[model samples]
Target chain A: MPYLIWALMRDCMPRRWWFGFFAGLLLATVLSFDTNLGAHSLGSYLAYVSVFPLVLLFRCGWVLQQRTSQGWPHQEKLRDSRGYKAPLVEFFGLSTLLLIIYVCASIPCWWNPYPSPPASAGYYPVTIHFGANDYWLFDLHSPVPASSTLLLTLDWSQVQNPEQDVWIQDPNGRKLQAIPGELLRWPLSPAEAKEGKMALHSLPKVGVELRRPLTRLEIPRPGMQQGPHLLLLQFLFFWPLFAMLLAWHRRGKLSGTLSAWTCFALGSLAAMPMQATDLDSGPLALLARAVLLLKLALPPVEGLLAAGARMERLAFTSAATSISGWLVLGALSLWLACKEKRPVQP
Target chain B: MSTATALILDNLVLHRGGKRLLGPLSLNLAAGQKGYLAGGNGAGKTTLMETICGFLPTVEGRIQTATPLGYVPQEPLFPLHLHCQDYLTQLFHLGCNRSMNCTQAVQEALHRFQLAAYGKHPIARLSRGWRQRLNLAQAWLGNPQLLLLDEPQTALDPEGMDCLQAAIQQTTAAVLIVAPEKSGCSKLAPLLGTLSVEAPCLI
Candidate 1:
């Protein structure tokens, strides 16, 4: 891919001027994404935003190195050289084998026949009804003892007064009022709270009242924590694919189409099982299985997934500044690639 | 008329930068013949050679050739990393290499140019003599039926000139060169006809 990109821009992007062009692009990306990123962890966002241009920079470095070492190479008139070729069947067979191994690594057959979902295991969803009472209490004793986050989803249409306040009281008798987004989220980190009861209060003193008939409540155990060894093993499941892609990219073989499609597949697999999205299941669920494989295979640890999510939105969204920048770069590259060359003087 | 002619240029007028460069010139070369071209600097000597090699288009004339053409520019440019032998091989490949085995052809070219000792050296590090020899060596590969050289002897030493002259004698192809001095390669001088061109701006 780097070779292709270099070939495309060779005439227009002379070696002497490419560094400045790259610096300008880097500065543009940084400034464009600055407003969307919080200053508290600016480094994380910068790293995320820098990935694409950094990849481009790596390619540019490779191009420069090759040029300095080799000078004007044989213009790869790929249109002419049809002598060396690979059969498509053989390539497809190899790709399929890798994909099968990926699937096997995703399923927890040898580890656990019945694996639980993470969102349900450590968290609870619930609804509460009040009988002209100041507060309603619910007991949750089946939950395994551990710390987790508590979340509340209330039906907005059922509230008679917009000023009404709804709050949750843990077994420690500590209460937290609902914040904005109408979805209350409080940390239920106490070990006792995992096996104890909690209450929902309708505080009329805060001019808050709930005129609802029924509330749906769901409490789950927080005992599904994955061991570090298991997590590492799952992460290494796609080792073969990772190795194959690295080998291909390093070697710089394979046709342009083959290289591009292979990278696309590899990138997509690496990005699946998004940290913030719920895993879906249904018919034709092999897609989900693939995502599950990557989920366990390339687990985003240390909040990397959240950072990636932010980067994805900024780089891919129509409103994002980087999208226009990339489009401009891509168009310029194409124009350079196709432009007619004026014959060189003898 | 010759039984076999390598090239034919009839009343050819060449132009560069929308200005007449050379001729109302006319020339013909029989198969396996050899000659030299002459002109002052900026006199369109290089331009005329390039035009004959089909590197540049003639403003008003026709060029008819019986065999494929090969060109060696005055200042030969090649990839700095290309090995001497690899450069020959690539030349062979470019010629569609129907005549002989690629390795054998490259070896023959290297031996002809006396470059076998420096086969492994990077072209950038090669001296001017070797670079010029390599340039001519590529033109000689796959035995171009007609070879056009533009001021090829400018940087070459006496031994280099002797080697090129000897190679020209050995080849069964029409060889034309642009030379400013009529000296050197004494044995081959009688056969070296001159194609004189004038400066394009003067015209």
Candidate 2:
């Protein structure tokens, strides 16, 4: 194994690999900085985490293609040396090292001088005060269902009057009146009352029927929201896909490396139709369903990325389908490696 | 499968695209013995070499080897980005010479092939003759028991040809050279026994 790794580093670590590595680092840093400056939400963080590794993996795949085309691991001197096992081990070893480097690059992004806030259930607190005859008309960052509920937390000590009704105005300027329920006030100590402290659970939940899709929301909160740490899972999902593509390229089915890249680009574009919110029974809906099935057949990396960017969890069925898709791709790659019999020509 | 034999072919027939190409011939080479295979154009000399190297599947019969083999195709390709020495070092690590020092093996190969001066040069910049010398260097790097050379004399100058002849004379491995004409085999005639690849009969 040590010799295999040394050989791979000697032969496979071309200048292009180093260029890609530094480029990926720069890209990840920029994306992380952008997320820190922009929404600072879970979706933005997840987007950064998902995208940077993808760029690196694409470059790695290109390097693999170039070396494989030049007859790496299957060169004349290396024939009959433990079959595909050596090459596979070498590739995975280098790829894992790349992932580790990526993680180290991400450590600076995770460093925040101030501690992060408590995890809210995907809710950003609106800082505007609710007063009688004064309406806060703001749009949501994303669309929500008509039956979605809004939570209102108010400190009684800071409230001018606690008996007014709060209404949520939809995009069409129609107001859905909020009926004030029983006062669910928390018993606060003297020090807490002096500090205007209030528990979030004691807040009132108001049912707001959004008549139309809200386009934007103006939340001026300062703290960054923590997203699910999905680096490990993203590595698991994408490494296999990259390996499968490498294996497929090595199989010589597609004419050349350019064709392999084109196929990957087309597959990525096919994942775009999955972002359509309304999939009615039109031709677009048909295309979307076909793409979804294709994603189910392939790695589904872009589908998962889209879902992560939208801060939406995949439906149980979709997640299951994607898992099975990953399994199939992984199995196919292993089968290709094992069934490979022809010597690679120089 | 005698211990002294380096390679054996018994009734070995080869096919390409369901058409019989080369076949039904058998030969054997003992350890340290040099052999030559001669054929005209469209004959199966290269095909047979590829088959023996496991690049092509045999349509009938078997090919057995007593030890690890090294092969040099008629037209070998190199990774253009690698330095000549680095390429040889990688090949040394990949070959069955793991017990030896890699740098020493690579340096020796460069010295033997007169590539010592070109060790730091990228393979892309090398001329055809130099590339052929590099190919020969890699084939003889790990000192495999069986060496398969397919038209290795193609791009060599007379000096390179002399170096090849001297290297072949000094090596203890069993060498099989595929030559397209008698002139290419003339210098090594005393050390090698020649075999001809016959044209396949039309069905």
Best by lDDT: 2
lDDT of 1 by residue, A264-314 (tens): 465445434233334556754778666567545432322211222222121
- Which of the CAPRI classes, incorrect, acceptable, medium or high, describes model 1? incorrect
lDDT of each: 0.49, 0.58
Residue A289, candidate 2: alpha-carbon lDDT:
80
The digit string of per-residue lDDT tens for model 2 on A196-275 reads 22222112323322222221222222223222234444455555555555556555444335534754664465344333
Q: Against the true structure, what is each candidate's TM-score?
A: 0.47, 0.70
Error of 1 at A266 (Å): 24
- What TM-score does candidate 1 get on C-alpha atoms? 0.47
Model 1, position A168, has a per-residue lDDT of: 54
How well does each candidate reproduce the native contacts, as fnat?
0.06, 0.29
Q: Put down candidate 2 lDDT per residue, B1-203, tens digits, no spaces.
A: 67788888788887777887776768788898887777677677788887887767666878887456777778787888888998887676555455777888889889988999999999999999999999999888877888888888988999999888888899898888878766576575342433434633221
lDDT of 1: 0.49
